[model samples]
Target: MEQLIKELESRARTLRYRIVKMIGPEEKGHLGGSCSIADVVTALYFHKMRHDPKQPKLRTRDRFLLSKGHAALVQYAALAECGYFPLSELDTLKELGSRLQGHPDMMKLPGVEANTGSLGQGLSIASGMAAALKLDGLDSKVYCVVGDGEMAEGQIWEAAMAASFYKLDNLVAILDRNGLQATGRIQERFNTNPVREKWESFGWHVLEIDGHDFAQIIEALDTADQVQGKPVMIIANTVKGKGIPFAEGVASFHNGTMTQEQFARACQLLEAEECEGR
Candidate 1:
């Protein structure tokens, strides 16, 4: 178990490295949310999800939707790491004619299941996919990662209600509860406290875990598979701008800029940790 966790941790660091590389000092991106969900995404793509990089559209492959689409860089990093596309293509991120856009585009990318970034809509999309798969009698599961800030959206609950009504047990939504949003703390902005209770009231199974912990993430996902008669919601407590000291828990870094020195320092810090772990 320790060895497995170490491998996942290393993959998370690599994903963070890719994120830093793609969103360089010259470009501003959703660094905080992306970093916050790095471990979760890493566990999914590298350890949990049944996906094939070479055959991204395979019907039997599990579907993953980044409902908090602003954090698409993390997903892109995982995809590139998974060999969905050449890592070199990531250099053109957010550029014109680049498949890697500011938000995920299902039509443009192979691994992206839904066109996201409008926020609050990806859950509904995932519910529909889950329902469709159920109707077709396919056991493929749908994994949707949502932002706690996006929980402010009315549509999320609506989708939550629908998932329960349909008993979409195959649908598992992981909430990135980093406590901070674009402007500031979620409570100061639009508090979505009692997140677990709210999802439970919606008639879904609820689980909470440390989002950055591979062991807990893996366990929660495993438990979700055994849950029946309802969809599962994992409320993951995470630190914003995780893995980088300057950015961790700093709300301003939600979409903050990085000076050349800051960027270099961030890179050095992450690399240093990776080396020490080795």
Candidate 2:
């Protein structure tokens, strides 16, 4: 476990640096939401999730659904780090004919379970998977990462209720509460202030923490597993462009192009963490 944590931290830093490098010239992709959840996704792909990069379709493996598909870059980063494919494939993201589409395509990408970009439906899919695993007597877990903005969709609640009804303890939902949508802040857009209370009311084991902290990510994931009878939700508080200087805590950078200057500055910041786990 200790060695795995060290490796995951290194891969996370490497991913951040590479994401900064991959932005701008290589399509200047969705840096905001991607950077926001890099740590969480890194921890999952590297340490927690039981997935095989070599044989992605292995039936008994755990599943992860990125319901907030805007952050495909984060998945791409983690995928490359975990050896799903060569790191070279990430530059083809969002390009025409590229397997790495703007969102996940399970058929194309190794280890991806859901081809999700649409909001609110991923939780339902994950719930179904969780129930199916239980029915089949499989011990696999299902994890779905959804944005706080996506919580506005009613389907999420329906899925939540269904999961609780079946006592799907194998399912876990994570809400990336960076709090910004395409237009503005989530509060101004839809107002999901009492998020934990809402989830708890619907019958979920909920935990909140700073999403960027590695230790918090580890502890939350562990606790989510030890929990009994109900599914779990980890509400991760994060900055939009977490490691970037100007972009950090700002929403404008959420889905915009990164100028050479901006990209350069971002790379420099990520470089400081290069020797993080050395």
Candidate 3:
């Protein structure tokens, strides 16, 4: 278990590094939210989720949907690292004709479960997928990553009700409660406080955790697997732009570009942290 934690921690760092590179210097991207959920994403793709890069459409594989789709860079990085496609394709991110786009497109990417980025809808889609998998008598689980900011949408609550009403135990939604959204703090923008109570009231099983902690993340996922009659919601408290010192908890970097010097510094900091972990 200790070695597994170390490996997952390293993968999270690598995912953050790739995210920084994908945005690059002076290239606008969803750096903050992407980095915020890097640990959860790493735990999913590299540790918890059952998937296959060689056979992405395998019926038995678990499904992951990034509800906060602007953070598609993290998922893209994972897919590339998992060998779903060539790693070099990452450089073409957001380029015209590239499979990688600002938002996830299932038609373009092999491992992406849905075309997301229109916040609040991915959860609904995941609920539907979970229902279908259940009907098919498949044990495959559906995992969705949602943003606290996106919780303002009525559709999300509706999906929550439906998933619980149907007892979609095979579904798990991880809420990236980073507090900040694209413009500013979520409470200042559209407060979604008391998140845990809200989900619990909706009949979903809830687990709260520090999003960046690998041990808690893995343990929560394992717990979700054991839940029986209700869908699980893991409310992960995280800092926006978690890894980069200057950007952490800063809203401006939500979808902002970095200067050349900032980019170099970001890389340096990430490298130093990675080395220290080893």
Candidate 4:
């Protein structure tokens, strides 16, 4: 178990590094949100989820949807690492005609289950997929990653209510409560406070935890698996731009660019974290 945690931690750092590299210097990207959820995304693709890279559409395989699709960088990194496509393709992110776009495109990417990024719609899509899987008698699970700011969407609550009403236990929604969004702090923009109570009121099995801690993340996922009725929502408290020293909790980095020096320093920080784990 210790080894697995260490490996996952190391992999998370790698994913962060990939995000930094993908953005490079002076090229804007969704760095903050991507880094904030790196640990959870790492835990899913590398540890918790049952998926096959070689056969992305394999029946009975679990599905992952990045509803907060701006952070598609993290998912792209995971998919590339898992060999869904060439690692070199990451360089073409957001480029004209590139398969790796700013937001997820299920038709362009093999491992991506749905085209996301509009906010508040991912949970709805995931709920439908979960329902379909259940109807098919498949024990597959569907996981959706949503941003705290995105929770303001009315569709999210509707989907939440529907999931609970239908008892879609096969669906799990992980909330990246990083506290910051593109413009400013989520509280300053659209305060979605009392998240836990709200989710509970909507009839979800809620689990709150430190998003960066692999132990808590894994345990929450395991606990989520045992939830028999209603969907599970794991509210992961995280820091925007988590591993990068200068960017942490800075709202500008939500979709900001970096200087060459900043980029180098980000890589160094991520490398140092990976080495520390070793």
Candidate 5:
């Protein structure tokens, strides 16, 4: 277990570095949100999800959707690290003719399950996929990550109701409660506080944990498997711009740019983390 945690931690750092490298100084991408979900995405791809980079379309493989699609960089990093595609492809992110775009395009990318980034739509899409999988008698599970700010969408609640109504136990929704959204604190904007009670009231099984804690993440996912009658929701508490000293918890970094010096500093911090883990 200790070794597994170490491996996952190391993988998260690599993913973060790649994310920072992909969003160059000229174009500010979704840095804060992407960094916030790095640990969760790492855990899902490396430790939890049953997937194959070699056979992405293989039946019975687990599905992952980034509902808050602007955070596609993290998923792209994970996919590249997992061999879904060559790492060199990451260098052309958002470039014309590149599969790595600003948002995930299922048609263009091999590992991306849905075209996301508009926010509030991923849950509905995931619910439909979950229902379809169950209808076909497939045991595969569908996992969707939604941002706290995205929960303001009425469609999310509708999907939540539908999941519980159909008892889609194979559906697990992870809430990235990173507090701040693109503009500012979610509470100051579209507050979605008391998320736990809201989810419980929605008739779903809910678990809360430190998003960066590998052990807690692994345990919560395992427990979600044991839950039977309803879908599971893991409310992961995270920090925006995690792992970078200057960016951590700073809302401006949500889609902030990074100069060459800042990028170097980010790399240094991630490398330091890797060394400490070693």
Candidate 6:
């Protein structure tokens, strides 16, 4: 368990620097939100998920959908780290003719199960996967990470209800509650507080934790797996751009550009974190 935590931490640190290095001037990135969920992605890809890098389409493997597709950098970093593709290809993010698009594409990418963007849709797709797995009698699980801002969509709730109604315990939804949306805080734009009670009302098991805390995340995931006759939802309270000192906990940095000096600073912080883990 200690080794898993250390491995996840090292991956999270490396992911941060890769994100920064990948984001140059006018770099076309989603730094704030992506960085905020790096730990969660790291934990999932490296420690939690059961997958084969050589055979991404393995039927019994766990499933993950980046519902908040704007944070493609997070998924890209994880994919690279997990050997879905070469890490060097990340340098071409958002570049024309590059396989790495701004959003995930299942057909184009090996590990990506679905093409996700335009919030509130991933849950429904996940529900379908869960339902099919149940029918096929496959012991597989589906995990979807949605943004707090994306919770405002009515479709999300509908999917939530359907998952509960069908008793899709193998389906897990994680909400990255970093407080801000594209324009403002979720409270200001469309308050979705009391998120726990709301999911409970829909007959789903709900757990909330600090999104960046590895221990808490693992605990919640364990609890999520124990839930039966219902689906599970984890509301992970996170800071936008978590590890970067200059960018952490702010909405503006979510999609802003970083200067070369700033990138170097970010790299330093990430490198220090890796060295500490060592």
- Best of the two (3, 6) by lDDT: 3
TM-scores for all candidates? 0.98, 0.94, 0.98, 0.98, 0.98, 0.97
lDDT of 2 by residue, 106-198 (tens): 888777788788889889999999999999999988988988888999999999899998899999888999998866898887797789999
Candidate 4 clashing pairs? Answer: none
Candidate 6 yields a Cα-based lDDT of 0.88
Give per-residue CA lDDT, model 6, range 77-101, as digits (tens).
Answer: 8899889899999998878988788
TM-score, predicted candidate 4 vs. hidden true structure: 0.98
For model 5, how does the per-residue alpha-carbon lDDT over 1-278 read when each residue is reduced to its tens digit? Answer: 99999999999999999998899765788899999989999999999999999999988899999999999999999999999999999999999999998999999999999999888999989999999999999999999999998998898999999999999999999999999977899999889888999999999999999999999999999999999989999999999988877888989899998878898888888888879888
Against the correct fold, how does model 1 do in TM-score?
A: 0.98
- List the global CA lDDT of all models: 0.93, 0.84, 0.95, 0.95, 0.93, 0.88
Ten contiguous residues minimizing lDDT sum, candidate 6: 20-29
Where does candidate 3 stray beyond 4 Å?
none
Q: Which ten-residue region of model 5 has the weakest summed lDDT?
A: 21-30
CA shift of 89, model 2, Å: 1.0
Pairs of colliding residues, candidate 3: none
Which residue pairs of candidate 1 clash? Answer: none
lDDT at 243, model 6: 87
Lowest summed lDDT window (length 10), candidate 3: 181-190
State the lDDT at 38 in candidate 1: 99
Evaluated at residue 123, the lDDT of candidate 3 is 99
Better of 2 and 3 by lDDT: 3
Cα RMSDs, all models: 0.8, 1.8, 0.8, 0.9, 1.0, 1.2
By TM-score, how accurate is candidate 2?
0.94
